[model samples]
Target: MSYLELEGLHLAYGNAPAVENLNLQAGEGELISLLGPSGCGKTTTMRAIAGLLAPRAGHIRLAGQDITQLPANRRDIGLVFQSYALFPHLTAFENVAFGLRLRRVPDASLRERVNEALRVVGLTEFAQRLPANMSGGQQQRVALARAFVIQPRLLLLDEPLSNLDAKLRVEMRSELRRLQRELGVTMLYVTHDQEEALALSDRIIVMRAGKIEQQGTPEDVYARPRTPFVADFMGWDNLLPAAQAPAAARARAPQATHFAWRPDAVNVGLGEHTGQVLARNYLGEYQEYLLGTPFGHIKAYAPVGAQWPEGHSVSFDLPAERAAPLMET
Candidate 1:
C-alpha cells in the first residue's frame, strides 16, 4: 500500500474551488513534487495534506490511517515553508528542539536528537547562532533540521529553497536531496520552479488550475509532454499545430494535433529551413536565438561559439525524432 494517499480530494476557499477530485499516492521514502504556477492549487494541495486547510470532501490516508479530519498538531507531519519560518529569538538548537520540547521528550534525548539533526544538515557549528545571524542557506538548514528532528511520518516542504540566490539554490537542492536520501523520509515538496522539481523529485505531479495536467518521471515529462500546456511548462519553446508543422514532424506523428520541441532540440547552422535571427542571447554555455521562421517565431539554442548576429540568415531543422507528439493544443 502507498504510504500516503489522497483520494477524490476536493478543496475550496469560500465558494471558489482550489483543487478538484485530486487523487495522488506516494510510496514510503518517495519524494513527490507538486509543480505548477502560482494559484494553480499546488500549494492548496500541500496545505490540505498538512492539515492547514480542511478539505471540502475526500479522504487522506497516511501510513494506513485516515487523517482527513486530524488536527495539524496531531497529524505527525513536519512542514518547512518558503520563509524558513524560524523564530527570530530562538537559537538554532532551540528552534530544532522546539517540537521535541512540545512532545515532552526528555532533555538528554532531545539534546542528542537535535544535535544529530543539525549534524545531518551540516549546521552543528551554527547551532547556537540566532536566525538573524545565519545566512539564508544556514537558516534553511536549521528549518530542515527542525523538521527532521521530529522524524514525522511525512514531510511537507512548500518552496523551501525559493528564497535563496541562484547559486545557493543549486547547492541547497543537492543538500536537500542528500538529506532526503540519508533519512529516507516520505516528502511532499511544493514548487512552481520546473528546474527545482526536475532536479529533486522522484516523480513530479504537474498541476493546472485545480487539477493534474500530468505526472511522471522527470525524463518522461520533460521529453514527452502529452498536452500543449505541459509542453510549454516543460520548456518546449517550439509548439506548432500539426497542420503548420514541418512535413517531417507531421509524418512522424500523424494523429497528433500539436507537436512540441525544446529550443535545444532544433538543429541550427545546417538544415532544410532558413530563418532570420531576430535576437541572440549569450547564455554562457549556449546561445539562445529568437528566429523568424516560415512557421512562426521559433526559439533555438546554438553553441556559444557559433555567434549569429541579429537579422542574419541561419539554417535550422525541426527534426521529427526530437518532436513530442501532443494530442491537445
Candidate 2:
C-alpha cells in the first residue's frame, strides 16, 4: 500500500472549490512535490494533507489509517512553512523539543531527541540561539529540525526555502534533499519554482486550476509535456500553431493545436525556417534569442560562443522528432 494517500479529496472555501477530485499517493521514503503557479491549488492541497484545512469530501490515509477528519495536531504530520514559523521566545533547542515535550517524553529522552534533530540539520552548536539571530538559511534548518523532531508519519514542506535569498535557497534545498535521504522519511513538498520542484522531487504532480494537470518523473514531464499549458509551464516559450509550424513538425502532432519545441532544441545557423533576432541575452553558458518569426516572437537558445546580434537573420530548425505537441482540448 502507498505510505500516504489522498483519495478523491475535495477542498473548498465555502461555496467555491479550491481543489476538486484530487487523488495522490506516495511511497515510503519518497519525496513528491506539488508544483504550479499561485491559485493553482498546490498550497490548498498541501494544507488539506496537513489537516490545516479540512477537506470537504474524501479520505486521507497515512500508513493505512484514515486521517481525513483528524485535527492537525493529532494527525502526526509535520509541516514547515515558508516563513519558518519559529517561536521568538524559544531557543532553537527548545523549539525542536516542543512537540516531544507536549507528548510528555521524559527529560532524558527529550534531550536526546532534540539534540539528534539538531544534529541532523547541522544545528548542534547554535541550539541555544534565537531565530532572530540566525541567517535565513539557518532559520529554515531550525524549522526543518523542529518538524522532523516529532518523528511524524509524513513531512509536509510548504515553500520552505522560499524566504531565503537566491544563493541560500539553493544551498538549503540541497541540504534538505540530503537530510530527507538520510532520514528515510516520506515528504510532500510544495513549490511554485519549477526548477526547485524538478531538482528535489522523486516525482512531480503538476497542478492547475484545482486539478492534476500532469504527474511524472522530472524527465518525463519536461521532455513530453501533454498540453499547451503544460508545455508553456515547463518553459517551452515558442509554441507555433500547427498550421504555422513546419510541415514535418505539424505531421508529428496531428491532434495538437500547438506544436512546440524547447529553445535549446532550436539549431541555429542552419535550416529552412528563418527569423530576425529581435534581442539576445547572454547567459553564462547559452545565449537566449528573441527572434521575430512569421508566426510570432520565438525564443531560442544557442551556445554563448555563437553570438547573433540584433537584426541578424538566423536560420533555425525545429526537428520533427523533438516537437512537444500540445492540445488545449
Report every candidate's CA lDDT.
0.94, 0.90
Q: Each model's TM-score, in the order given?
A: 0.97, 0.97
Compared to the true structure, candidate 2 yields what TM-score? 0.97
Where does candidate 2 have its weakest 10-residue lDDT segment? 247-256
Off by over 4 Å in 1: none
lDDT of 2 by residue, 215-311 (tens): 9999877888988878889998888888898889877668879888899888887888899999999888889999888768888889888888999
Model 1 C-alpha RMSD to native: 1.3
Where is model 2 more than 4 Å wrong at Cα? Answer: none
